[model samples]
Target: MKPLLAWHQSLWQQVLASWQQDHLAHALLLCGPQGMGKAQFARNLAETILCETGQACGKCKACNLFKAETHPDLLQVEIGEKSKIITVDQIRNFIQYCTLTSSYGGYQIAILNPAEAMNNNAANSLLKLLEEPPAKTLIMLISHQPMALNATIRSRCQRLDFSRPDKKLTLAWLQNQLSSTQDAQLLLNLSAQAPLAALSLAQDIKKRGELFQSLNQLVTKKEDPIEIAQQWNKHNPKQILEWMNSWIMDMIRYSLTANSNSINNKDSIKTLQNFAKQFDLQALFKLLDLQTEAYRLITAQTNIKAQGLLETIAIAWHKN
Candidate 1:
C-alpha cells in the first residue's frame, strides 16, 4: 500500500528520476504481462507525482487522501463487463477532470490499466488529450501487450517495459514475502520467476494443490494424459497452461543437462528424468513447443476446448 514492492524498485526509480527532473512525459505506456504489478506501479507513480513536498512522501495531505481512496486529482480507469472500451463516455468524463485545475496544485494523474482494452473511438478520444496534454497533468497507460494499442497512441507516449525477474532474485523476494504471510512455495510453483505472479497464486491454495496433484498423477502413474489435461483445463485453463509449461521445461532441462534446478515438481521430476532419458533434443523441443503453443492460445482469445487442449498435450507429450 506504500507504493513499494521488492520486485519493482528499478521501475520506481526510472519513473521517479525522469519525473523528478523535467524530462518526464505527459503520457507513459507501461507494458508488462498480466498480474505482473503494472497496476501497482501505476498507483505508486500516481501517488509519487501528486506528493506535495517530494516524490511519494506518504505523510503528505494529498498522499493521505490517496491512501484513503478519495484523492480528487488522482483518477483510475479500467474496463468492466459493462462496456468494452474505457467507453467514450468514460473518457469524456475523465477529460473534464484533466482539464480542470488540480485541487492539489501539482500533477493531476490518470491511470488507464490495460490501455489496449480501449476501442477505436475511445482511443481516438484519448488521442486528442495526448496530442494536447494539459499542463502539470500525467497519464499512465498500463498494458500487457503494447502491440495491441494503436500505433498512433503508442507514438505519443514514453514506453516502459516491466520484465520478469531472474530466479535467484525471485526467490530472495519470495523469502521476504514469506516473512509476513503464509505465501510460501505455492507462489514459486505458480509463477516460475515472476514474483508478483507467484504472489497472486498464493490466494488460492486448494486449487493450486489440486492442479499440482493432477499433474503429478499424470506424470507418476501414466494416466490417460488427455483425460488428465481435460480435467485440469476444465478447472482453470491458465493454471493448466502454466503447469504444462513448467512440466515441459523440466523435461527439456533434464534431457539436455540432467539438471533439476528448474523443476519444482520434486515428486514428479523422477518421471521427467526417465522421460528425458528416452527422449532426445528434437523430441523434447517439439514437446516444449506443443505446450508453449497451447499456453499462447489459451492466453489469447482462442476458443479451443479442454479436450482439444488435452489431445494436443497428449500428442506432444509422447512426441517422437
Candidate 2:
C-alpha cells in the first residue's frame, strides 16, 4: 500500500501504537475536511489490523488479499453510484457482513466513507451496530461533516480529527507534487488549505482565471449579469460559487484590512482593491451574504434554479 501523507504520518503512528497495545476502539470515527486523507488512514489502519504481524506487511497473505481487493474480512460502504445517500439496506448488508467470522482469523473491518451520506434510516441501522459491536471487529466511519451525523452515533465512537496540517509542511508537500510551476500557496488558499484538494485544484487554476475575468467584467458593469449567468450555467455550480465566494471574500478582506497580502486572490489584488474601494463594507458584506446563500443552496441540492441564483449574485455585483 502507498504510504500516508506527511501530515497523516503522526496520526498513523498514534493509531499504530494504540493497535499495538490492543486498545484500539471497536468503532472509530475519522472526522475531517475532504482531501485530508482520512479515507487512506482508515484503509491503512484496517490493513494493519488484518495483517499477520499487525504491521500491514505486504508479504503476508492478508496484506496480499487486501492489495488484491479481495479481503474477506473487510467491507467498504459508501453511497451508491446513482444515489446521493447511503440507504438502510446498504447499512444492513454491512452489519450482516460484520457478524461473520474473520476469514483470516483476525480483525473484521468495515469502512463507511463519508458517513454523513447515510440517511436517517441508514444512520439508525449503523447505530445499532455501534451499540453492540461484534468481537474483534473494527468499524471505521469516515466523515467530512461529523456534526451532520446522529449525536448518539458520534458519541459511540472515538473520533480522530484530521484538521488542517502545518502551513509550511503542507505547502512544501504540495509544491513537490505539482508537475509544473504553480503557486502552492495560492492552490492551498483556494482549497481551504487541504493539500490533496490543492493538488486537485491545480488543473482548474486556468479555468478559475477565466472565471475571475468574467467576475471583473461583471463588477465593472462591462458585462450583462443575465448573459454572464447563462454562460456560467454550463459550468459546475458548486465550484463556480466557491470561486465567487473567494473573490468576494477577498474584496471584503481588502476593504477591512487594506492589506493585499491578507487576501487569497493575490493574482487579482489590484482588481480587488479597486473594486473594494467602490463599495462600503456593508455593501461588500451584503454581496458576500448573497454569494454565501447561493453556495449553500447549491450544495444542499435545493430545487432553486442555478442560473437564476447565479444571475442574482451577478446582478448584486453589477449593481453594487
Candidate 3:
C-alpha cells in the first residue's frame, strides 16, 4: 500500500478516528484547491474500509482486487473523454450500483471527482442518492471549487478541506522530492504552495520562465502584443491566463503595499515592481478582470476563439 502523504496526515487521522468510533459519515465532500491529492485520500479510505484487516493491507484479497482495478464494490465516476460534463445517466448508473450488496461483504464505495462538473439534471439525480444513501456504503465527492456545487449537495456531505500546507512544510517536502532547493522554492511559489502541484510544475518551469520573459518584453514595448498572443495561444491558453492572473495580482499587491512578501512571483519582483509603477490600480484591476473572464470562459468550455481572447488581453496589457 502507498504511504499516506505527509500533508494529508492530519485529515487521514481524523478519518481513521471517525471510523474507529463508528461515527464516519455516509458521504464526504473533499473540497480544496486542485492537486492536493484528495482523490488519493478517498481511494485509500475506501481500500481501508474494504480490507479484511480494516486497514489497506496490500496482501489482502480485496486489496489485490482494488489494485487490479476489478473491485466490484468500488465505483469511480468522472466526465467522459468526449464530454465536458458528467451526465445524469452516469449518476443514475452509480446510484444503481450503490444499491447492490458488496461482493466482498465490505463497505461499498463510490467516488465522484470534480463533482461540480455535473449539470443540473446530473446534480439533482445525485441529490436523491445523497438524501437516501445505501446501507454500509460510502460516497465521496471531490471538488476543487466547492461553491460551484449545489448548496443542497454541499450541505449533505461532511466537508474535508484540503488547503495548502505551511510554507516550511511544503518547501521541506518539495526540497526532498526535487534535486535543487532553489527549484523547489520556485515551483512552490508557482503552484501557490500546493506540493503536488509544485512537483507537477517542475517540467513546465522553463516554459513558465520563457512566458514571463515574453510578458516582460511586452511590458517594455519590445514585443508585439498580437505576435505574443499568437505564441501564447500555441501553448495552454488556460494556464497562461492563470499565470497572468497571478502576476497581475502580485503587481497589485506590491503597488498597494510596497511589500515584497505580498508578491507570489518573488523571482520576478523587479519586473513586477516596474509593472506596478507603470499601471495605476484601476488599470491593473481592469487587466485582471479581463484575464479572469477569459479564464472563466475557457473553463466553462464556451466556444470562444483562443487566439482572439489572448490577443484582446495582450493588447489590453500593452495599452496599459
- Candidate order by lDDT, decreasing, is 3, 2, 1
Q: For candidate 1, lDDT tens digit of each residue in 1-320?
A: 46476668876787789887889999999887776678888887787777787666788898799999899999888876444456778878777778988886777888887788777888898899999999988888998788999999999999887766455666787777665656456566556456777666666556756765665555455567667766766667767667667767787877667687666666566666766676688877877787787776665443555568667676555444
Q: Which runs of model 3 end up more than 4 angstroms from their true locations?
A: 164-167, 181-183
Better of 2 and 3 by TM-score: 3
- TM-score for candidate 3, residues paired by index: 0.93
What is the C-alpha RMSD, rounded to one decimal, of candidate 1? 4.8
Kindly provide the TM-score of model 1 when superposed on the true structure, using C-alpha atoms: 0.70
- Alpha-carbon lDDT, every model: 0.74, 0.86, 0.87
Candidate 1 off by > 4 Å: 1-3, 34-36, 55-61, 81-104, 119-125, 164-170, 179-192, 202-209, 216-234, 249-268, 275-320
Ranking by TM-score: 3, 2, 1
Could you estimate the TM-score for every candidate?
Answer: 0.70, 0.90, 0.93
User: lDDT per residue, candidate 2, 34-78, as tens digits?
Assistant: 878888888888888888887888999999999999989999998
Better of 1 and 2 by TM-score: 2
The C-alpha local distance difference test score for the whole of candidate 3 amounts to: 0.87
Residue-level lDDT of model 3, residues 201-234, one tens digit each, is 8877777888999888888889999999999998
Between which residue pairs do clashes occur in model 3? Answer: none
Per-residue lDDT of 47 in model 1? 78
Candidate 2: lDDT of 230?
87
